[model samples]
Target: MQFIDLKAQYDQIERDVNERIHAVLQHGQYINGPEVRELENRLAEFVGTAHCIGAASGTGALLMAMMALGISAGDEVITSPFSFVATAETIALLGAVPVFVDIEPDTCNIDPGLIEAAITDKTKAIMAVSLFGQCADFDAINAVARRHGLPVIEDAAQSFGATYKGNPSCGLSTIGCTSFFPSKPLGCYGDGGACFTSDEILATRMREIREHGQDRRYHHPRLGINGRLDSIQAAVLLAKLPLFPHEIEKRRTIGRQYTEALAHDRIIPPVVRPHNTSVYAQLTIRVDDRDALQEALKQQDIPTAVYYPVSLHHQPVFLRPDAHLPVSDEVAAHVLSLPMHPYLSDEQIRRVTTAVLEAV
Candidate 1:
């Protein structure tokens, strides 16, 4: 019945988790410790990237990536308005503009088709968010970016373990960023994130930026922030890393089951494209009476969530009165995320799906 069964996952890895944390505690190097470097190396290897820079949070990773890319004031970053605010917030935080674009209704990811039209002289980068654990169409997106000669940053916060066209999510772009928030597909005990890239210069820049732009201790070379990921969190991740492949498979199975069970005239199940494999960060569905259906499911003790109730263009902080992202607007009002995790039982999936089908 748990939305995300962290307890079950913890139980499975308790010994390793405890051992890793105990080692970290004994080492007493809480910040920028050896564990952090080890985790970075492991993550980079998994993602098929040359470097991985640990960060304080996913927001920090995005900010550092943008900073390392030299995105500055008045520079426009074209991105999906349908994603978590952090996707656009990081851009705005740098005094850069986040140009909102529509998303594909099925994937709820930024529509690459609309991206080229949004690009202008001010467009500095294209930030493609891999929403709901599914990667956006990177091949097409990358093609467009190549034409514009712009960098593409995949916001893989929700799709870290996902694959797009035989490539890992984080390694499919100029700079890829993912979160280690507790509920994410691959997560730590507390806030953490990492940036991935093959570019050595960008990698060095991100590493320096992660430590307040210090090339050497107590010597600052550029403006940056304290975005370092702590050792304890790194330890948690290292312990969990080995179990990720299994967890991802479980999630995919659960997702497939949910999709099969929720097939009805009134419910619109998630669509995983032919070339992509999702980690099912959230097994979301669309329904007309979303609030009513949520209430009905809640009455049956089924926990459901709305990833986003309003599109970014409609948010007060980033209001765009002239914005015309019709698909983003429509999907926002209808999408609902059901209980999703690697530990979801067959019975649990059935219960949730039954409630949903009846409610709809």
Candidate 2:
């Protein structure tokens, strides 16, 4: 079976997607075309945020947010160790230190209780990653950020379609960044991303940051990168946005089925927060013998992946000599991701769950 059945999803929306692409091609405004603004507007409405700025990739979105916040050398950004490298990579790329806190063993998200201890005078922002498409406890994290007078950036790359209480994922913090990589829940055909914010100043800053720090054509105001999303990708996302809500519901339904099917197994299913809905971006689970389980699942023709095999603290490039996160270390060793997508059928889910249960 396919890990993420993008082909099946395309089969349903091919006509609309093709029409949108044709329009973009005819207009020839490949850079900042009308479709790019249209997508930004649609995403802003969906995220319940005042503004959204298109980016080249999720990493670009995070980089722009850091720049907008004025994070500089000797600055520190508190974040979870247990996430995709982009979460911490963006911080380090800005000449700032990524102060990683341990994760909650269940959700694999940054443990908010441990965040305060990691902060210091150098702490510029609290970057909380929404791992496995479920948002971290933003209320608790935001309370801590408020007490410390620090801004919070929600790394909503995986949780774009998710909701925390009644608020959307990208609207839960001072700045929200999400990826539109092909594998993400609200993905486009290629690399694309966005930054969401209610603050007009920050929004304006990000818009400039995405375009080489230009206030207007050739008016360079500050250092920035070529991070704008292309019009073709914007067209693809615009076409997909209409069906995103239904797809999110389908993922939840499949997640429930996977949970029920493996209820009696030794493997541990995902623990979604009471106030949040996951988009099941990875459908990760824990097992005692993850390596063996992965091999066995392969034998059963069920594709499995490892979302994160190493903690940020343990990465050779971004190594920290002093800090040690036990939960991040432990979870990294055991986590495995099953094939997940809205297009997955009941029979496909049963096949996946059955293989995983037997393997574990």
Candidate 3:
């Protein structure tokens, strides 16, 4: 069985996708075509935000948010180490320091309690990653940020359709960034991403930053990058957007099946918060011997992956051994993501679960 089954998803939306692409081709305005603006408008409405600015990639979206927020050298952005490197990479790219914070062992999201201690005069923002398709504790994170007068940017790359306390993931923070990497919960045919904001001024700034700091043609207001998302990708995403709610429901059903079947096994299924719903971007689990279990599953033709084998603080590129975050370290050694997607069949899930149970 395929890991994500993008082919099945494509088949479901083939007609709509073809129509959208045909229109884009006919228009021939492939750069920042009309489809781009349409997608931004639809996504902004879906996320309950005032604005959405599509970017080249999720990493580019984060970089644009940082630039719009005026993060610079010597500034510190607090975030968890138990996330994709882009969470911290964007901060460092701006010559700013990423203050590593420990995550909650259950949710694997940044611990808000640890955030206050990390704040200083240089703390400009809180970059909270909604890891593994679950939203972080935005209420608590926002409380801390409000106390410190810092903006919170939600890295909702994996949790686009996820909900926390009835609010959408991207609408829960000062600024929310999500990716359209093909494997994400809501994705396009190619690399694409968007930044969302309720603040009009910040939204205006993000729009300018996304197009090389230009408020209009030949006018450069500030330093920015070519972060615009392509029209073809926008068209692909627009076609996919209409079916996203149904896909999220399918993913939830599959996740529930995995949780019920694997709960008593040697592996631990992903944890869900009381008021939160995960999109199950990765149906991850923890095992005693991750490597051994992975091998055993592979022998059965069941694929598995490790969200991260090494924490950002421990990466050779960072090389900061003194930065100790215990939860991230422990999780890196134990966490493994199983085959997950809306297209996973009941039989495939059963087979994968059976293999996992036997292996452990």
Query: lDDT scores for all predictions?
Result: 0.95, 0.92, 0.93
Model 3 poorest 10 in a row by lDDT: 315-324
Q: By how many angstroms RMSD does model 2 differ from the true structure? A: 0.9
At residue 122, give the lDDT of candidate 1. Answer: 96
Question: Would you give me the overall lDDT of model 2?
Answer: 0.92
Tens-digit lDDT string for candidate 3 (1-360): 888889999999999999999999998999999999999999999999999999999999999999999999999999989888899999999999999999999888999899999999989999999999999999999999999899999999999999999999999999999999999999888899999999999998988998889999999999899999999999999999879999999999998999999987567789999899999889999999999999998888888889989998987766578887998899899999999999888899889998988888
Across 149-212, the per-residue lDDT of candidate 2 in tens digits comes to 9999999999999999978999999999999999999999889999999999999999998889
Could you give candidate 1's per-residue lDDT for residues 1-360 as a string of tens digits?
889989999999999999999998998999989999999999999999999999999999999999999999999999999989999899999999999989998899999899999999999999999999999999999999999899999999999999998999999999999999999999999999999999999999999998889999999998899999999999999999999999999999999999999999999999999999999999999999998998998898888889999889888999999999999999999999999999888988888988887777
Q: All predictions: root-mean-square deviation over Cα?
A: 0.6, 0.9, 0.8
Q: What is the lDDT of residue 231 in candidate 3?
A: 96
For model 2 the local lDDT of residue 79 reads 93
